[model samples]
Target chain A: MSQYSEDSGYVVAVDVGGTSMKGGVVTRSGEVVATDRRPTGAEGGPENVVAAIRSFVGDLAARGSSLLGRAPAAVGIAVPGLVDDATATALYAANLGWRDVPATGLVPLDVPVLLGHDVRTGGLAESVLGAGRELTDFLFLPIGTGIAGAMIIKGGPYGGTSGWAGEIGHIPVFPEGERCACGQTGCLETYASAAAVARRYSARAASPATAERVAALTAAGDPVAVKVWDDAVEALSLALATYTLLLDPSAIVLGGGLAEAGPLLSDPLAARLGERLTFRSAPPLRKAALGVSAGMLGAALLGWRAAGVPDARASWALDVPKTSAVP
Target chain B: MSQYSEDSGYVVAVDVGGTSMKGGVVTRSGEVVATDRRPTGAEGGPENVVAAIRSFVGDLAARGSSLLGRAPAAVGIAVPGLVDDATATALYAANLGWRDVPATGLVPLDVPVLLGHDVRTGGLAESVLGAGRELTDFLFLPIGTGIAGAMIIKGGPYGGTSGWAGEIGHIPVFPEGERCACGQTGCLETYASAAAVARRYSARAASPATAERVAALTAAGDPVAVKVWDDAVEALSLALATYTLLLDPSAIVLGGGLAEAGPLLSDPLAARLGERLTFRSAPPLRKAALGVSAGMLGAALLGWRAAGVPDARASWALDVPKTSAVP
Candidate 1:
């Protein structure tokens, strides 16, 4: 038995990562009709990755058709790249080695399609229904293997003049500190990212350790882990302090792997951020509500937007907190 | 006596600074029919300053009436400190000792009025008819006694979530460096501001030197002057690198007293800014075109905008480059 009728409008939404892609059949009413996850085939080539995405979109649409008795009205995809929204093209994706892929070329059907930057699409989800729901302007930072910010300005993601905005990870925090892999000195990512935390702790401890393990060790009063964790917090506080003074965002929403440490990260970051900012009060720190599903759900909203349903998220009666994880 | 006819419309424009206030009558054809300058009366307090502003606005409008044979269409003012655009209130002025002075209260006429923040208003002039005329997104940085930036986004000045967005001066560039007058450590203003440059040079050279003298000495290969200038350039490079990574602006328009150093300041800053960025090209640094008259011109535009003449700068040609100095 289906909750949606045969005439219910639906769209195909996909979130494409470097390793894998997640595709879903989303109805206009915000129901997830079906979802499928698969490898992006990026190791083969850009052509193979495009083929994988096309196949995934077709498969999801077919599943949606079987459930709703109709083809998808439109498609929306979130990809790791610099997107040219005016031309509906993915300008470049460093990880996937893809460039200038038109939105329509990725879909098998004759439906309209939309494409967005991966992190910014996730920020859209956070802004619409996640942690930044009430914030009109804020920074959405996902601290994982890497760090980048989605600057949600005036209720939407601001990509700047050339869609190269929000590259906060590369901003130099310690002007005289260690050299970054990006060839810059003292980049915030060199000390604060999840991978960085793990690497620094492992190097000091003379043993391999994950960022999670390092966090656990720090909690258990391990000296090396504590030092590494403290450095991360200090670097983040400096970056956040700079961000606050320049942009004056109402709040800063934290996401991705490191945020999962909960109070361990937020407590120290908040204290130092306050100390660094002398004139203005630091913006409140918040936990991301949607977690990993943010990109897919945001793609769904994009799908509905492409289908000409601009108020798609408005009618969504979702219980996001209750269904935190999707299996 | 007047160049224009009786039907020619005009507006009163004022730019209020910490020490002095300038007033002008701007015709619809972009003509400055009359101009006057007076002290802001800050020595007597906020009330006297408000009275001075009110008297200036009335005098300018009366002169405009004599030329155009009608009451002025509207008034526009640029004031220091925080301004609330929505409520048309000068929220606070630290130097002038004023708080929440309404725009209507500053004008003694039955005409519409508008207000703008001083530096942002100057940026608006640069954006409309000056150096940044062709740019839609850029930064207007004035490194005077103090430092601040006017972030022009999407063809207008963006004040951010709380109208405090462009505090680029206060961002901590050197986390463990010297404390600033604002009580922050390693703030960009502490190292890069013209006042800071002069003060630093005087302290090291055992003699007082203006920023201009420091620039000349740096050019003449004085080691102390070179070191102080180098530190300023280094701090600027770090700040600009962070801004570029985060915002991706097209260009940076340099103004204020330090910028008058011209290539002496911009050349080294440009080279260092380029060196700091590892992933992307640095935004080109351009000299501010309007020099000191930017605020008054922007006020005139605001006056036109208040009079419902939105595209006020479309007609009436003026050679900005040739007429660098207003007097």
Candidate 2:
């Protein structure tokens, strides 16, 4: 263990998803230890979801301490929707059916708490430890079950004055097309999200195949799947192109489940973005590196930072204790 | 005169435009007391334009000393295009026909010089003293012969990392629409600029008339006039709606010649924007109060701040020595 290690010191990180609650202990160097997952129990109300999170955190802490000999010193949690970082409040989360959730107070641990929006926290991870680490200005856009993004300006995440700055998914892409779950018509998420891709392919193909099968068909030159895939790429390109003109980022990092397609996504997106931009430099398109662990790593970083750990080195040092209390 | 105003002293403020150069002495209280104008003479080349500005400043200083009763302490210049405010460098301005214009040495002023983009400086004036003074996070969009905007974030203008933050007019509105002078297709300016309104009305009207005449006829419910007017409103609304989702600004201040249409522009724009935004709050739309002098006022404010003029007092008191020498 390094000089900064404390026997009772740990950093807890949680990612609150629409369907599940995933969390773990993270050492200062961006490593996840003793991670655990459970259904969000969202339909059981916010209290039940909190109870699940508490249980998850308790189990992770027990396992992490037994393995590494430490108790957490601080905690960080991320959720979807409008967040009030200044107040540590979850102002709203449409998917989780939460409003003004005082996340900082909900954690039973007597430690410093940090709260952030999920996509932004994911972006924080990318900006600090992923593909965007070298770029001062970049947009971290994750196209997954639903589409969302975070803007990094001058190496810092920019939450608009209202904390809704990176809601690019809500922007109308098709003008008057299909209605979105958000009650809007033709939002980018309705067309470009992973779920949207599957739904669109299923509707068009009428063969009722899984998204993976659709991707396979698209690769094999199936016309219906090709058309659906092309439309998704086109929509994503337009959205990204619009963002390039507006923000002029140095690069764009594509993450989330759908990004697993790798070059299948990056190649077409780069071409479309390049074609749209004339006078401005077309930012490079890259895939996110941290993968599914990005959110927890980011949340842990947030926790360490909130506890006044200045840099990644300090966090890493705090991860492993020099001595074990049980021994 | 104010305390800082001394006879033979002067402050230079330059307004760099697409086709011409306008500049003058700006009083400490945001007033332009003496002014000069000349063709930017870009046809002679970028070097010639710089030489013209140098001569213009020298001539203005030589002639306006008696009128001003003091030498200027600082200079503030507003230019068109991307400007890196941190380094005081004009990164790129297509209209000015210059790239990376080093403003510090270009102006050739002895006093402290403050440089800012023309539209952003105008936005500063609007935010401090014009239509948007009461609101935070407002957009100042000026639609004249061309279109551009300045975003006021958290009560200060956001000069994007490269100083190209507020290019709202360049965002693509129609993917397959007309080509823009900027070599892009379907830019908002191609459809909504004052020049665009005149051109569209001329091409589509049965008996073509001046934009003023078209405006009058549109007021009287002529079908062609109404169509042209509605199309412009549609483009502007779409652009503003996209901006609303991105920035969530509190209000939008409309300036420049097109704003003179008053209710003809605002009423339809409000209705269209409202129809488009379902989840987000629709920012209030209003006309700019500074009108033709917004840039000048902004320039003056920049001069005042650069000269170390405090804002607590409304006016400055200057002592001028008696002098009889005349040029």
Candidate 3:
């Protein structure tokens, strides 16, 4: 049943979100040999989530060993929060109700483990393997459950002081807009994130629906859907225009679930961004190529980097793999 | 008599603003040996302004030769607008009525000549010799005739592609705000810039006053002045909060004419910035130490760098000379 060669090497890449933990055993060239997904059970509290993460890492290592006839060379985990990646500490994750959680120490594996910010890791994957492959300066914004940004400057991710750069979601768009859960008012995410889109539409629509369904309804010319969607687009444009004037990235890569709506999101967002700008031209708006897998793959890239693999060698994974290399 | 020796090297520094051109011959440690000032004559057109800059550079070079017994080693100039620092071209300066002007080529100097964007050069000076000394990450905002920023990341200036980064003035702070000269509505400069503050006050008050006088009137409880000042503070705080969330700088350094008001700007700005931030802490706000001379001093630093001077050696000029090296 094992397909991987004993001579081959691999790393465990995991993305831990509010709802679930997704992981994979990835080869040096970024090929995913196998994957595992499970509920985070955050409602049970921080201890339960930590235990789940530990068990998942163990399960992946065991699975990799069984499939490859050897243990993984390293492990990388991506988690949301104000993470201090250097110390592998999840300083705080509001969604998970945890603080100062040492995520790296949770894993039982003997191999080296690295922890990273989930959004930044996703951005790294996009920067190297997906939409931002050739861009030296760009922003990878994932409009998933919430909106955050991964700033790529001079071909690498820029983590501002304390590794908390790119918290663009918290930036206020409307001076007197609605209050945010973050104790702030009129945050960009409150108006434009996937969660926001669905919550707003559901509040007024005759039939409650997810952001995806709202997009469909909007396309059908439902006045309420159209109005909500347009407001979201406008808010996003204003925030992005602010970002453009400050950083002037070459392009913006939209990722996460909302980005999956394709042209429906990209077209209007791009046009509105253009209208918002004055003298400065808007960079091309692009969709993420790797979809939900960007975070997992980005985690693998971080692992490979931690393992001291050269960027040139790491980038070889971008080419479609011809085989599993398990002979 | 010049204190610099015949053997000692020097650089000519010029800061070209919309209304005036300030130039000086500076010793390596940032001491001004000889100085000259002239009207930019921008109203006479780009060609006239170009002639003034050439004369200023030439005058400083001659003054340095006569004082120090030798010509200066190099020259550095800082000008406004969307400067292509790499090409040393003034791409477009609305105030100067110039487009695609070769600034570096205009200065008929044999030694190496360096040209930089005016605000960025001032930021460089602050980073090395003024308030931001020893700080690794900070933003240098000079709110004078207009508001522009110089971003210092990892101890050096970050000029985005084409050297147009830090154009924070253009960022729309008000959606339905006043129309800006740049063809945009409700830009940050439209409300908070030094020029805007004075102009807005003059439009409302029976007697026209500078931003400094407006600050005094606001302190005296003049309702109109208080209202205008509060609006500017709010708009500036909003922009700064956005910046803080995005970059998380260690500090924010305020420079230029408006900054000269000291506590009037810093106190309200710090308090408002603190109020606007939720999870993130506000970076300490500080006034620029070098005052109006920051641009000229930064230009000298640039020249010294272009002339192969190390930072350690370049800083030696900070020590006031007891006697001219010419002795």
Which candidate should be chosen as best, given TM-score against the real structure?
A: 1
2 or 3, greater by DockQ = 3
What is each candidate's DockQ, to 2 decimals? 0.87, 0.51, 0.72
Ignoring the other chain, what TM-score does chain B have in each prediction? 0.96, 0.87, 0.92
Ten contiguous residues with the weakest lDDT in model 3 chain B: B318-327
10 residues in a row with least lDDT, candidate 1 chain B:
B318-327
Q: Rank order by TM-score, top first?
A: 1, 3, 2
Clashing pairs in 3: B3-B324, B29-B317
TM-score of candidate 2 relative to the true fold: 0.89
Query: Native-vs-model 1 lDDT?
Result: 0.90
Q: What is the per-residue lDDT of model 1 for residues B123-221, given as tens digits with 9 covering 90 to 100?
A: 998998888998999999988999989999888998988788999999989998999999999999999999999999999999999999999999999
Clashing pairs in 1: none
Which parts of model 1 are misplaced by more than 4 Å? A318-324, B5-7, B316-325
Q: Highest DockQ, which number?
A: 1
Q: What is the lDDT of residue A24 in candidate 1?
A: 79
- Once model 1 is optimally superposed onto the true structure by TM-score, how far is the C-alpha of residue A101 displaced, in angstroms? 1.7
Q: Write the per-residue lDDT of candidate 2 for residues B74-161, one digit (tens) a residue.
A: 7777888887777777777776677877766666657777778899898987887778876768899999988888888777777765
The regions of model 2 sitting more than 4 angstroms off are A1-4, A62-70, A310-327, B1-10, B29-32, B35-37, B62-64, B67-69, B134-136, B206-210, B304-327
